[model samples]
Target chain A: MVSAMICLLKMPCAVVCSKIAKRGGAAWISTLAYSLAVYAGAPDVDQIFSARWAAGIDDGRSQLFELGWRPEARWRFNDGGRLTGRLRLRVQTESGTRPGNIENDSFAPATRPQTIGETGELDLRELYYERPLDDWYLTIGKQQVVWGKADGLKVLDVVNPQSFREFILEDFEQSRIPLWTFNAERSIDDWLGGDWTLQLLWIPDQTYHALPKQNATYAFSSPRLAPQPPPGVSALIRSSEKPDRLFADSDAGMRLSGFVSGWDVSINYLYQYDNRPALHQRFISGATPLVEITPRYHRMHVLGGTFSHAIGDWVIRGELGYFSGRYFLSNASQAQDGVASSPELSVVIGLDWSGVEDMFISVQWFESWLSDYRQGFTRPERDNSLSLLTRRYFWNDTLQAELLWIANTHDNDGLLRPSLSYELEDNLEVRAGLDIFYGKRAGLFGQFDNNDRFYISLRYGL
Target chain B: MKIQQLFGMGVLLMLICEAVWSTPLPDADEIARRINARDEGVAVARSLTMRLTDRRGKTRTRETRAFRKYYGKEKRTVIFYLKPANVRNTAFLTWDYPQADKDDDQWLYLPAMRKVRRISASDRGDYFLGTDLTYEDIKLETRVSMNDYRRKTTGEDEVDGHHCYLLESIPVDEDTARELGYGRVEQCVDSEIWMVRRSRFWDIKGKPLKTSYFRDIRKVQGIWTQHRIEVENHKSGHRTLFLFRDVDYEHGVSDDLFTQNALRRGL
Candidate 1:
């Protein structure tokens, strides 16, 4: 009996038992095999299966109104696989007319709105399948994979392109564009006397960066992210060109992560097309000079790594990336292409401390340097940014207060967010917050100074 | 026949008297060591349901699946939250070592972020997942920390029909007391099973903080297991209850489940 049980453990006993029955095997053998299979392949019947639904409404002082709902479902299979999905619906209305915007979806098809509505959109946010096969774990479908340790910033975490519809005011999970990807991971126990994991990713989704629509509340009017023509120079902006072939233009990456000597580290590499479009220009002179700007997507390479370690209530994390084939907007008169290609390096280091009773604090420093310096690029050769985040919980962790500040040192501009949330119940919450921007008109956050607003939101989940 | 029966009864009574008087009870340190080195299964998997009741009498519930395994002298544990939409798929992993001088490595994985974050273990005194029990309390459930306290046998007591030895433990130093947020702790250990049946804690300022009760203990797969634990905060009028079920000691959980990669992949 013990030997038979061991044999049943080696293979799917049901299949073996069926084959034996077809061959007229002994009755007891078939009965034993089938019984063991039934016991081994049974799912966890005691587990709770639930669907989550959340409804929320937000009202802002700037007359920005949004009512949203999300429904999420999860399923587990007897074969140790899982399926998860989420759908989001939102209705947005703005009382004031915004200025300066591009045509909706001027870049890629994925940027187009999903539903046919002027003020409402129903979208499928996420759908994924996760399965464990032998030693490898696989997740396939539309999802987001974060690859960095920096908070409120990006260094090596560029796997998914982002939507600037709210201009960095929304959480990255809400703004990040999910892509169809095949992810696989496996762990090695005795590699160099350390625990390590190797992860591989193949993303065939051809979605590009998304920009806000015209007359939207957070449309861009700045010179850096949006177009700003010079004096008396008429500019014709052409639609962006993107790769349409599926697997031929896919992005691939590999990451090897491990824990060694109390430090968690990962080395990552990715080859993919840049999320942002590069402006290629043609200058037409004589009788009214016209500069034709043609937006095109280019491929790039990224190599980076992340490391983190904790010591006595403090965690220090850092990420560094070396990017090749990076393109930037330029106005130099060299050959009049309006774009320059250069190698770039970016790094971010952050520290999180939780020594205070119920308070948590984090500070980060970020920098990006263009190795091949050009004189007339839109940005400086080296750019620096800093961020600070503080959060505290009160009343037995039912009330939370948080503040996040991100500043561009070179542009002397920053965004400040302060928020408070109280849990009215286990599944209900009320929150109020302010989104404030300050500094130079041509800078990042400064351009959004006109959009400063206070907002309140309530959410109930079931 | 009556004479023979009387003689036999007298012999049995004398034997019982000899057994009771000749055996010496173990000292406090020996009892502590026995509690720390109790024969818990090498690997265990169980389902846990935690309910937290606030001062206003409002209650919130959370469900999870927990797994633990011993690797030589070190221990590793991983927990996955199973219910409640806000915290679903969130997981915590800890790699604990036997040495008191070495800090355990801890990691947290948030499904929304899709990232594994390393967190400091020094703040174990903080409440865990908003429950009345602190992280230290949960970590020390299966084993006791023998190095941190000076223990002495206080007295004897009866709890739920079991004879228990009462013990008083004082922090070895002011720093240790501050770190654990405990000035002193009193425990009731079941004399027969050598399990801690009840514990009372005092804050650093020597004020009553909370009490925990372990109940419904049973032997499964030849290992003693606690099926229910309740903690009540005296000052806050708050309480937390943990009920464990479907415990298996022969699950043979994979070693990979304790790593960061497995943490990101929900069970």
Candidate 2:
């Protein structure tokens, strides 16, 4: 046992110390080093640590710079059970001014991003316990559950709320807010001449979208997302109304998946609050009129299904979702609350091809249609989006180049991301990329046109 | 005079019998059957180390633990990445059918995405994870396709001091050749051990593509196993080496381990 412990120390120490020494000084790296010390002290635990730092190029003003360190640990028991804990230590500088008075946006305080030392925050990302019991697998704790088959677009992947702080620039794994959930799954054999599985989820954490506050780096200031008051009118905005109770405001979902004839398919249903808030407005008529806007959360019903089939070198995937009781903000004259309830239908069809050696290409078409359309709504009756992604690996998988383009047909606005990453060593990587946006301000990607910049990041993991 | 004629006819018959007895080698089809019928155990579990070397001589290593089980005529395989922190806990599962016309099913579990994605199995010609060996090369190993290829015994050769028979195989059609990325392949099959000791592959354009050497052939649990393999690509000056260790065939894997759920559960 002593010799084994010595072997373990030598292994991680060589990897961690060498990487740290190469990267030199960084506060997050020091934190990671401290975490490693704790890891080395525990012999029965398995841990993973990584640090990343990204800085944006100059666009006339101070550019965005952020550093983060994440440490995850897993413990296994003799009874075939495992417990995992993960945390993130993040700090940001030159990211413009921070948002104020919106820290408690999520329903659960623990799930909210905890601010520290003005520009730093500590987040408990995930803590879960998983065990296999007879024929069922059970995982209960704060975790992130992903669904659907779409990429870069949400059709049925609404299980967890997301942070729009960077406007979809970050990976979903980092931006998604983990919720306290009870998840279970069971597999059935010889069911209808196919293999099938059923998964169930019960989430008590009613976290809402952590939207960017006003005046922040990636805040919503356009007319489409955030309407401006008329010159003669004044507006008063109130705090968002969120669900407070745990059991009463909980969310639940069920999914049944099956494989038949070389196709994988799943049907799902979720009953939960719409992460996007609906604006409830009241206009007063007087010499000086005032508009009162209140953000409120409403329950929604979502039914969706996804299917994927692989044919030769191509894989085709599709997802469809039907949403009811969802409200949309409108600018109609007769609107009482400045919003209208609309039933929405969303569909995504994607194809991934790997015909070329060392290259992958994927194209997707996403559409959302409102069954009950209203005039003067912020969005169109039928919103269409097309996305193309291509990735190629060179130098024996040590260097990678990728491009992702997403365009909205109605708004004619799109985002183009081109990035190149190289592996410096076994667990260290360096990447540089550009985020470019085009089109009018009323579009989704257009709102970030001025924020287009080049960025570089360094990542080290063990 | 009649007795002399009968004795001469008997001598001719004896000569013919002797010629037939001297030709003891089996045909290509019979040899393929014997190679496929070799007892490779009901289940196998092992750890693999793959080293990929570039033209610049930079080597990258990847470690994985794999399990394989045979269910009648079908085979199921699951591999979990054990090294490289970025890809750790990632798993791949494949269910291979015996019929040549049927396509196999494969699924990949990505830890970062926390999702199981179905991937195409027919892209067998594509390299697996930037390795010199293609997916077909790793999946089928030395097993030759009776439907896709036309095989014939070319001649005799010696590999690693062992007498071997040379078998040359060509894809039956243009489409098969294009799909396999191979115009022709010559295999050196050991006479005593029905396993390929060395193989050379040509590109679909009839250019010399790569050559693979199977080494360290030994018996584990009374079954012939190749513990090491090296492939050198001629077109591109790259090479890949695979080393398998701690092979176990006695402890059979559970049928449940072949399911997609097992991929998500991870190692």
Candidate 3:
């Protein structure tokens, strides 16, 4: 439906722009702009440009966008069978790590706008078919599984592996868990009742988006390396390995999730995961940098759950998980323990004062443990974290506002960030925010090393 | 004859039992009509004051106002901030009752950088006028249906003067649960005029959490209005009073008032 509306809007522009050709320059510019609009709306084909017709999803942090028939409908249902399919193509250009220039190599800066990179991705993001019974549902296909429960600012997105770091879709980001397997779910009226979802998927090679000096992918320029048999095998070397490629393969895995305790407790678990190292680990291990949240190990398993209870005006929520298998780090992905003896577990808790009509204050804390953090970053940001936020309104409906405080690694390394927003009208909004960090700060922790910058954004949606 | 008579006796007994158990529904249709009748078409300017006492008894005060109107298929609501720094001047336009479940089309205009922007549904729970009420709350009647409206056992104990109808508002969906954050909201509106008097909200598991009172009911242009609404946190003792002052019904609010252009016009 969204796509059809877009196309209808384009047809008139094409005819009108072509008719004004005799007007010369003005007509040409109109034609160019019209073409750009079409290109932007053509995310379906992953054209050079795509439209920002998001109507946008305004999350607490940012406004993200999307559009239609989209991700695609590969299947339909009939008397005995159902069909479905999806093709997703995306292209992204983002700047990552800063202070990488010859001037600032060893010393990490507060914020650097130099981490720029690009990716052209094409995949059948979802293809599935389901046969449903009055009491049960069975679905089988290549699907994406999202096992996220925490209203997390970091970590705990342990479902299907993707670019776990950097800018990716947030909402609906945890909507899919797919694989090439059949699953069934049941609904019943009893003391305790909920749907039990089960599935299997061949996990895809993992990758990350724009995070400067972060991620596991490695990029290098030294022409000489081992496993090459010297100069004589240089010709065959072309078939051996590349400097920018990560050694990771997606494996077939299974997933199970459902709600228990009368639609309150959400349980999510996954096992037999094909752990692929990130680009960095692949690079360090191979002679290449991996992409995104690539694992160092080859095989691993994960299990997790989240629960929430309303205690008076306070809503308490928590999530926890365990991961075991290959753990890798670095640009060249290396391998960690091949067994469950050394597993990583993470837990988080949040309390919200939700009784008030328009204002609220919420606080959350997180702790992650990976005994053998392969190349485990001891950085405050890569470790434990906590955050508190408060928001209120004033003087009628003229102003809307918010305030946030984040403390990581026991405030020994963290940020004291505050932001304010004002609404001009329905279509325009302006925001300005500041970040104050103490102790040691890097990555998303600090934007410019010891310095701070004001961040601002203005958006208008039709 | 003997068997037939005996069967008739059994049927009569069952009828009497059924009559006793079945709740006697009152003029519920009349009650629903009254509940939906208020502000049917009104241009209202409301002044609101919010006082919050945190877990530690520290109090913070915030004041604001909302200009509202109801037209054919549109309910235009605009909010303006009245006090506190940083948010000294801000506005949001919402077009409710469009096509979906009281969906609110919201936009905020910021003077700091001079811009206007829209907010999403997920973020609706964030904040509104810097108070505990979310955008979800502003959109009323989230399936608040009348069960059985009956006269209270002690109606003669009038708080003001007129007799009030005690009504139970049972939410039928998650939106209401998330908004009210309560199991049920019991209310009292004047029986004669249907102007709300007071209400108490409870959680799904039946935990008393919050109480609110909408008093000073008056008729403005034949429309009964509750000029004052006070919401109190049962557990914290903090409260916010929303007062409707200088209210006018059917004043014909312009469509232009809901745009970014007018929002920048400011107070």
Candidate 4:
């Protein structure tokens, strides 16, 4: 919540100070997108975040919204199947000054007046219609989909990017978008020795679909991702939990993602030449451990492929590719440089262990270098990061022990850091960590003054 | 005799019956009877790691976990997949023996798509990772109710100080193409532990397709567990080896854990 305020206060200020009418539809968009980010995979509880709170060990609106994964029951009398209803309501306050806690629900209005020191809004992340088939299932309306495995910061959750930014900057609170989507999947044949699954996604809205734009700073919208005031400005540190910049010109488009041979791959081609003329040109970013500027982009091509293999307790995984042609980037200004991005390459390699069944741990090293970090094909020498992360799981499915340590550079800077997380329960967790920096992209998270951070979150399935 | 003595005598009856271990060169009748009487039942979770060799035979590995809880009248299972991704999955199934529905309610929660789906009545011969283990293999609705075991051969083996049975037997059922799940299922059981040492399967066309070898057998709560299990897909030329460290059973299972609620709980 504090992070979102920092972002609100730091917003280009132009938008926030603009005549109310000038805000346009962007307001509502960012608003809906704000709080839903917490629940995208609220039920899966795949990583360190959703703990004690989600599994019902604790029941609070924010914790449930962040970690809760509720169920709606169904029974079929005939072959047609049964109808079921599932709904989640999370309550939270905006400015904290808002009385009665009405502003707390996931459905609370984004731009509430006199809300208090709070610069954010309560959100209703997902409310969709679900139609289940024997072998095929569909969820329409507002929903979240994770195309890739590695989540928590959109490194490769290609299917959907729940808004982690709105929580950072109140300006985007109303502009956030949840991809109105339809998903279908079936286990086809096991022809090649591995079970083959065919899945289809129909997105009514692409707000959640990742539409990477270049030249624009990847503002986490929260304190950490957003640029901080030059040291002396304030004594308080600001940061957002998993911040990444995104520009989803959600007119109408769909992305198809799948996997084969240890690699997680996707080919997202959204074109609306007649409507949003600007987005007609494809925009691509190196989608890996979070989007980084990539030299490869084509107004015509957009693609990303990642592969990670765990061989006898050792995992080796990473992604590679290129995009070419006139691509999209920072509101059309940076692209004026003739070439939008560095037209470079990105990759991350990680390894883990499985020798022990009850206990497992993993470490991954990520690298993303732009062949033209200096600019269009100019400087051939490339640069990225060489970071390492570790995650471990404890007994049954209750506790998770995780650590993240990254070494090397982002853009052209050195990053040395560590993140620690302890599983309080299946749905709630408390985390504290820090990043040390020594270069450009080092303003926050890895910025000055130790850059330490602490967070506590809980989830409840409605 | 007092009830206490009767209970103890019943156990003694079972152990003394271990004399059946002596290879009597029993006829098909005696062999079938002896083999079917093995075990206090066990639950298994097998993790299969695949290395897909392309047309050029270059290999790439992907990992997946198959969890199975097998008992008297039924067996329930769930499979979680990782990598070679389109197939990354979570499937729940219950196979009841001597039950009306035959195959229990089955639900698959896919992590990739993030949806739990129900599978209607499916055919048994369906493929299992491109191997002989078919959709029927996962569902134990059909058991060796009636079989004629012809000991084609025997070998001496020891696992954890227990004598093992490595005998070859051909199943009796045929004409089972679309309806039945297994064309043929071969077996090898440990004498003392009663743990299945190895098993093989052939497709309906009578072609050997997949094989599972169990090792590291140990007794847990009066039940035998094979700490290690390996399933090889012959057609795909790939194999998945599962290493089990801590194996516990019937500790405290809340019925709710098996409900649709748990599915959404992402348990």
Pick the DockQ winner.
2
* Whole-model lDDT per candidate: 0.78, 0.81, 0.47, 0.39
Candidate 1 deviant stretches above 4 angstroms: A1-63, A95-113, A190-193, A232-236, A281-292, B1-25
TM-score of each: 0.86, 0.88, 0.44, 0.44
* Residue A219 in model 3: lDDT: 18
- Model-by-model DockQ, in order: 0.31, 0.49, 0.05, 0.04
**Candidate 4 displacement at residue A58 in angstroms:** 30
| Clash totals, every prediction | 0, 0, 111, 61
Candidate 2: which stretches are off by over 4 Å? A1-62, A97-103, A190-193, A232-237, A282-292, B1-25
Q: Which runs in model 4 stand beyond 4 Å of their true positions?
A: A1-120, A130-137, A149-156, A166-177, A186-195, A206-300, A308-310, A325-345, A356-359, A365-383, A393-399, A407-451, A458-462, B1-76, B79-267
User: Which window of 10 residues has the lowest lDDT sum in candidate 4 chain A?
Assistant: A272-281
Per residue, candidate 3 scores C-alpha lDDT tens digits across B16-93 of: 998988655445456556666655445666565555444445445555666777677567778776444334457877
Error of 3 at A29 (Å): 30
User: Which structure among the candidates has the greatest TM-score?
Assistant: 2
Q: Please rank every candidate by DockQ, starting with the best.
A: 2, 1, 3, 4
* Ranking according to TM-score, highest score first: 2, 1, 3, 4
Residue by residue across A1-462, what tens digits does model 1's lDDT show? Answer: 976676667566466445544444122333342354354443222211221111212333445566777766555677888766555666665433211232434333432334424566544565677988997889987778889999779878798888776788766877787777899987766555578888899998777777665466666666665556667888877777778778899999999988888999999999989887787888778789887877778899999999999999899999999999788877777736878888999999999998866778999999999999788787788999999999998767788999999999999999999989887777677788888889987888898887777777776665
Candidate 3 CAPRI level: incorrect
Candidate 3 ranges beyond 4 A from true positions: A1-146, A160-263, A272-297, A326-341, A371-383, A393-399, A441-451, B1-267
